[model samples]
Target: MVKKDTALGTGTMADRITDDEFERRMYSHDIAPLPKEMEAIFNTMPDFVVRPKSAKEVSNIIHVAQRKKLPVIPRGGASWGLGGCIPVKGGILLDMSTMDNIIEIDGDNLTATVEAGITWKKLCDTLERKGYFLGAYPSSAPSATVAGWINTGGVGIGTYKYGGAGDMIRNMEVVLPNGDIINTGFDYVMPNGSGYNLNWLFVGSEGTLGVVTKVTFKIYPAPEKFESISYSFNNLKQVGAAIHDITRAPINPFHMGFGDAMHYEYLRKVGIKAPKVGSLLTVTFEGAKEIVKYEEKVVDSIIAKHGGKSLGTEVGAHEWSSRSYEFKVRKMGLGAIPGEILVPMNTFSKVLDDTAKLIKKMKLKVPMIGSVADRNSVMVMPYYLTDKRKFVRSLTTMGFNKKFADIAFKHNGRPVGLGLFFACNVEKMFGREGSNLMHEIKSAIDPNDIMNPGKLVRTTTGFGFDAPGFAMNMGLGLLASVRSLLPRDTFGEKK
Candidate 1:
């Protein structure tokens, strides 16, 4: 626990706190490599970082943050492209990655209790060893934390069939901004029939509500089999149509993801072994052997009906295995900015068509990957490759995200999360009253407004100025328009 101090963080929570500039710089950003020029817009660095090993330690740290009235940003795997974990005011950063301990594996009760810092891959691997299954997990499981995914989008692999990470969570131990630790939901049974689901309140809250220290997730007995199959489509619209048909069918797939030929072409350019098919869709079914076999046949008929051809099981398994490394081609240039959006099946094809046109008009070398988030929603992520090393050019690339969100809005869809980059869209997505209420709720829970002070609700700069909502939209639009007039990219073309 940190002692009340006027100078800086003092005392000890197992002596894990650090005020060193070198270490503080590391906690400044997440997966997205923002250019140094962004320093002019915000204070991306943290003044201090503390690695809490237990919920009690986390609470202790929060208590100190309250006394000092400093913002406490909870950081897990740091895999999010958004600036959810970045501190705008350069306060204390709670590094949760080290507290990854599996506290309980209630096999009989079908629940696994673990520290929130546990990576999806680690938890899933551990559960598999006990003959249990983690039905829903993020595709970025290799580094994404359980709490991180829940806070980000709350949707990932097995989302279409078993629902998202929120559906599996039975309970969570959260440390509020006031340093009080509370548990939401039940231990073994599903939480229900309540006035409001407190668990859901924290879900997709983007760490502004509180720090999720521990969690209990409903687990399943290992499936008897997992069957994967792939199909090839002539174009992205055709692929979307087939997905629409398949999702409308009676059967439910464990997971389904697709990629256009251009995406694979880029992958192949980087020496990745991707199928040359114009468009690829991979589907997986998990359950009893007989049921999975039946599902494979049902899906085959659907694909055949939609002018698709089977790509054999080998390619299917390959695609499934590569879910976490979707952007291996990032090595070709600077890593991409993934504009993730969720659109309904009705407009999915149109969104795909328009997005392709948008990419062409912007003169970008982009590739798209999509998946069925649920029966009604599909998640489309367009990875626009850009050279962030070229300072001014990198700033222009941000325009793509703004324009992309506009496209989603036009088609009655929306961007995945309101992280720092997309904070201005809160009103557009949640409405004026709802957006105001969201900020009120934030103030209600965090009186000091120190829990991730500059994200989601609105962006704040280190200079203690809020980015005006109108200016945000206006600036983004102008940047995008400017990008449209810029020359085309040939960075990835064979020269």
Candidate 2:
């Protein structure tokens, strides 16, 4: 159990590092809202919480942690839902958000060097004033840190065309697990010449490898005509065909995202103005005005070929503007847990159909949203509203996500992030040899297991017990079955 008094603050920690109970409590959780009953297993509170304004300070802390053999959890805005930043065992928590600063912006080179803690929204807004923008950013850009999104998958708007974080990073400044600083690529040149292409390794490493202090990312000039248009389909078949054909078409849009009618219904339930349609695809076109106009014609032809009607520029603009807060319905007074999976375009219709069925089978009313990532894959997100006040019953809803992953897996897809809860899938996500190699790499770099231990490399409770993968699956399955048998959750349902 964590300490309840102020004595933890009186330790030998540096003046900047604090053991204050109030601050530690605040930093313990990101936005997950995990139940108090969970305190029995995972200890969220840290023995120390420090905000380092520079990479050197970060190095010093990591050195201290290494000496003491304590786990070091480096964090940004702490906006992610998964227990990525949450501590399984008590250790030092490095809050990087306070270090947010724009280091440099080379307009001639079209790159921005920023401290890892800056929010995507802040950086985007600042760049807009100077007529520049990022190639891709997280959907939670307003609050998620640049490093946090890059640490995760780094797929969002502009990803369909401009690619993800791994593709955009020209150079990355990372403080390794052993307090050594290294640059993965050149600051002003393309990173292609190379040896391991180290930047890609850290992009999705999830802080298990090292702490990213600064990054120089490739940027783009703000488009001359950045516009979005939408089309409504009678059903999922037409929607799927429209997306599939659009991918095969001779044009490339900046972004593509869609939602079934039920998704909009949930949005309207929360009073967000959304198009009332069975299903619709919103496509964003960017470039010269004439180019955008011509591309719109091509997209319209494809939509018409698939039996879809245009929703016009107005609704499309609203949809594009509201992309970041797609799951705002969570504010309707219940715990909202989202499950995200990525699959090929061929399995798009099947996945949506199965998602609808799973929702019904689980007695859930929430809906699903999808976005095109590239030519090969598309991401789908499904959310469920749970009354956390019910405690055990609410915890059981996690089975829906596990079952959700099963559906994605069967369709040649996988879930997005593997923080604490989903760490068991490491071996399944990667092949046996690949998984073993990843563990070996983790062990090699962080020999003491101090860099975000009990995470992606493996699963361990605060009690030092490792959770078996099959056992986790069975437990989740049982919980899901138990949840299905309980009385239906009637929150936000129409009378």
Candidate 3:
């Protein structure tokens, strides 16, 4: 149990630092944290949240942290509700927000270069003026830093058309743990048969590998005309089938999302209403005026075949302007834990059915609202009945992750990435055998265990049967069955 009112603002190392120098460097930028937010994480409180104006300044801070042997957590926007931005080891919070600047916009080359801290919404605004756009439109667009989106594996409304954020990265300039700057991939239009494709490694590495200083990504020309269509279904089964058919169409959609009835009802309570509950599908298309109109007809045919009812309303041209701003709507004190799970396109229905059943079985007091991020990814925001109840607040993420992984594996789908720190305690997701392989990789790169020591790397510890938090997570009967499923050797082995 953490002390609720303890003044843990001061750590032993904070006292050792020269007061004059610390004070001088502290307020050179912005640093502010209220009591409620700071108290959530354990054993971590930054001495100062330092916002530097350039890559040189960022590299300098890393050098300073190394000299002091202080654990540093790099942060931007600070909009993440999870402990992603929290300094679990408690040292300096390196704020990269001040490094935000658009370095280049190659309209003819269809690429743009930008600093790490610019928000997605800001990027979109800038690109709209030039008639070019990027694909990573994660819900945190309004305030989330572009680097945060890349680091955390951003997926958004445009996924149906452009694919994941990792797919959009052309190259990047990163500041490593040793304070040396390195560019992962070549800055050319196409691959030049270079030595290796190191840029791909840092995409979802989450600041654990290095602090991204600059990025270059491919962009598309914005369509002059856009259309939004929402359809209602009597049940999720129909919604799933409708999406599958529409996505299989000859023409591609600009953006597409599927929201189950429960999600629509939740949105209704919050003053936004759509077609009646069982399921809702929103599809947007863009392109030449004639082409868009032609594809709209095919979409209508598919909808009719699936028995979808028109919601009697069309999202205006500006409707998707705020699509990425969904995070802001939920940030207003509504307790929600948004978990993203990716499954194979074929097994999507089974996974959803199994997940819904498990959520109901847990007797979770929170509403389980869900939406389809893309054909391969699903987003579920579990909401507690009340913000104060401990069980409801806990979100029971273990079940969703474990079950989803099983389904993904069975359907031949694999998890490419997950949002920040969840990978720290990610034994279950990777499992014992897989984690052993990860250990080997981590040991090779960070031989001294000096680079973000505990971020994504975990020791083998042999073949321990005990799953972290697994025993206490389930009810008595469920826990007994799970324990029984393991071999006795697993309980008494040291491999």
Candidate 4:
């Protein structure tokens, strides 16, 4: 039973508290009403879902949680595909969507100051009307928030040209667990001091250190003209080579993505089809009209050299749009678990080939798609249909992830925070040292571990990986297998 929040209580978000008081504090956000399949994973149901309308309200909620030593999980749009946003400890679901307000647009500085709750789609819509744009467009754009995007280190369709979401942020305002509001660098917009960059610390911390109240991003001028094209290759090697060659060239495509032949066939089953080939590449570019035309010619030459058959301009754009939102479509049908992994440039071909082979070996049913980054390596999202073969697909998903991590690690590649199937297995994947570092950071900022505990970082078990709840549902025996595989002191000891 949750008790009422008495006193101002640390001056955070909500002035009042308790599960019974939820109806009054929270408004318009859905409860834990999740599908049966997801309930088992979420563990505990949040006692209340609070929809705060302002930063003060957010701070108040944090203060209340801190006073009560209760856990609070911040959620934006509630469109997170992974279990990251699910409140495993069951306390308060701080829905930030209500605070969706675009604070200001500084055209002179080429930046936009926005609240954490503002949706990316809404922001982009407003920017589009003004002939300006935020460079990154994660596939979740229709429902993903700008703050959520930054918090999770989002990689979008335009990442090939613009870089990751972290690269676009200039400064931000974060509220730490101690109820201290700190402005990182965005305060320097008016000029205070020019030493040390602290915004990056909170950007990818994934809401562990603090609750992000507002964000400032470096926006770019919208391209005057844009073109999308798709090409199909009879072989995976050719497709990989084509991606490498095209990206390595002078023309920088705004978006570049790839899908295996099986993936295209799966889309065809649902009345959507790319050019017939073993693998397909979809490239979209934006620039001045003449520049787009010239780039198109150059891209075509590279495709021809790699034995890629052009599917023309019309079909290509449609394909790119469809591919961009493919995950959403998959959700409505079979529902897919994404496997997002980044790799180094030189070994990209091998990674792609290895990923394809893993999917084949697992005999899982889903599309395996990838987006190239500067011809170095690709961020792969392999869709696994969870509805058909639940247990088998789940196990296969885990296996495929292990394959990706093992192979990528061997190739000197690192994971970009999260992945699809094993989204919450960062500690397991990275090992003890990495896990401890993440936990220590969380502890320093949130000593009581009141903010989204067990989501990104976990507490020390004091008894190795076999610690209580360490295995969760994976069982004690399987935990042994997993523990055996992790490198001891994973975060690394000096030298």
lDDT of each: 0.86, 0.83, 0.58, 0.66
Q: What is the TM-score of each candidate against the true structure?
A: 0.97, 0.95, 0.78, 0.82
Where is model 2 more than 4 Å wrong at Cα? 1-15
In candidate 1, the residue pairs with backbone N, CA or C atoms under 3 Å apart (3 or more residues apart, or in different chains) clash, namely none
lDDT of 1 by residue, 392-492 (tens): 66677788888888888999999887788778889999899999999999999987888988888888998878998889988888877778888877757
C-alpha positional error of residue 162 in candidate 3 after TM-score superposition, expressed in Å: 1.3
Question: What is candidate 4's TM-score against the reference?
Answer: 0.82
In model 2, what lDDT does residue 98 have? 77
lDDT tens digits by residue: candidate 3, 1-495: 112122212333333222234652432221112123223433345555556666766667677666666555677776554445554445556677777898889987888898988887788889989888776577667778888777766566677678766777788888877778888775546444756567767766666677888888889888877788777778767877777787667877777666665554555555653345577667787888898888888888898999987653354232354455343324323344454556655677776676566555544433344445565555444432223233322333333444444445565554434332345334555777776776676556544433443354431111212223333234323432443343321111135
- Residue pairs clashing in model 2 are none
Query: Which 10 residues in a row give candidate 4 its minimum summed lDDT?
Result: 459-468
- The window of 10 residues in a row where model 1 has the poorest summed lDDT is 1-10
Instruction: Report the number of the highest-TM-score candidate.
Output: 1
Error of 4 at 296 (Å): 2.0
